[model samples]
Target: MTTTPNPTLIYPPKPSILFTNIHFYISHKPFTSSSSPKSNSFTIKCSGNASSDPKNSDGGLKNLLSGIVDERVDELLNREENRVLLDGLDKATQRVEIAKRELAQIEQQELENKKMKEYINQLEIRAAEIEECQKELLEARTLVDEAERSLEVEIEDKNSTMTETEREEMYKNKERFESVKAASVSAIVGTLAGLPISLTQAANTSQLILPSVITLISCALFGVTFRYAVRRDLDNFQLKTGTSAAFAFVKGLATLGGGPPMELEVGSISSHAFTGAVYISENLLIFLFAAVGLDFCIKLRILSPFPIETDVSTTKVD
Candidate 1:
């Protein structure tokens, strides 16, 4: 009796008690028994949440990863912005260079146009000057031509007047010469007519008549004497006797007749009668002939005409 002391009745402990204890035990035991396993599971879940949430692992490790990702994103954004800015800057520089080049080209074109216009203006001015010079030259040539023509006309008129004057002088000279010749011939005839008479006689009573008759007789005697002398000389020399004989016959006929045929031989008389006649007649006659010849020489020289020459220069006109 004491032994199993109501093992059953002992209530093995009251059932509530047992259940409560069991519950306590079970709760406590599960906590104790699988504490390590549960801790491992909880750890795994926490790791998974942490990994999935991308929130935290080691504090330094989380910080490093966050910093690396942030730095990479910043680098990409900065690189893109820098590229855009560089492109903008390059485009602006190119535009500036193009503007500079265009400005230089416009300046160069303006300079060239200015130079061309200046050259054209100079050429036009030169052309006008050349035309004016040509006109002046033509005018000068025309003036020269006119002057030459006037000079030529004047020279011609002067030459004509001189020629007319010379012709008139020549005509006057010819007339004077003719008159002088007539006078000389008359003087000679008068001398010959008086020669024989002056030599024939010296009688005071018949002085006048004697002189006239003696002049005629002396002329006849001189003619006969000259004929005889020529014939004698021809015969003595055996030279051309025909002329001498003819002269002698004419002299003989003159001596037989009383005519003027014997008067031609008045220069040949040498007898006293003939010489006296010659002295009275030929002395004055010779003086007269000499005077007439001298006058003729002087007058001819005075009346002679000379030639004149004229020269003129001329220019051509257009």
Candidate 2:
């Protein structure tokens, strides 16, 4: 019973048909592993067949090597495609960041431009205010100048009125003084006229003739001095008042009435009449006549007149 053959231990010769079938199977379907099928599948097939037959092993090994090379090339190509995709993603992200930065910069520039525009507007408003203020200042100055001119005109008018009033008051005072002087002169003339011719004759022949002659001469001298004083006072008043007409009128009236005349009354009358005629003919000559006449009267009063005997002796032949 132990003499039956163990089929598992029996070694049979490899058949050509079996080797050819194995080669066909290896060529069509190389050994595949779950973990790394592309790299290990061809290597397993080549190693398994190399031990089976020498002639078939060489061809199988060559084909397995070619398949392994192709698998390695495919793995390299897949790795390259993944790397390109990652790089593209990174570039896209960088472009997006750059766009965001550009947008922020543009926004900042816009904000700055808005601020500058507002500042320019404020400056323009301030300039307008300054112009308005300047206009107001000029207007105020013009008004002040007009007010000053009006005040000056008012002051001039007031001064003119005051001067007119003073002139009127001076004229009134002068008229009153002339009236009093005329009344005094008339009273003196009336007192001299009351003396009788018989009394004058008795006084000339008697011992009292010297005293009477002296008294008459003194009276005549006093009358002449008083008349000249009144005329000089009136003339000075007229000169101060710049009224030559007033002085000329007083002189003409006094001369016609013979108030300041003694024995040479006709000469006095003729001279005064000539001066009055000259003053009436040309009013501009009044000032000169009044001045000369007033000066002559003052000089006549200052210098004593020569006695009648001396005058007669001088006229007679020595």
Which residue ranges in model 1 land beyond 4 Å of their true spot?
1-81, 164-318
**Per-candidate local distance difference test:** 0.46, 0.49
| Model 1 worst lDDT run, 10 consecutive residues | 17-26
**Per-residue accuracy of model 1 over 149-252 as CA lDDT, tens digit each:** 99999977875666545655655565455444433443344345444444554456466664444334433333333233332232233332333244334433
Clashing pairs in 2: none
TM-score of each: 0.28, 0.28
- How far off is residue 50 in model 1, in Å? 39
Residue runs of model 2 more than 4 Å from their true location after superposition: 1-78, 162-318
Q: Give the Å shift of residue 196 in candidate 1.
A: 74
lDDT of 2 by residue, 144-251 (tens): 999999999997687456654564565556545544433334333322332332254454557545434533343333333434344435445544334445443554
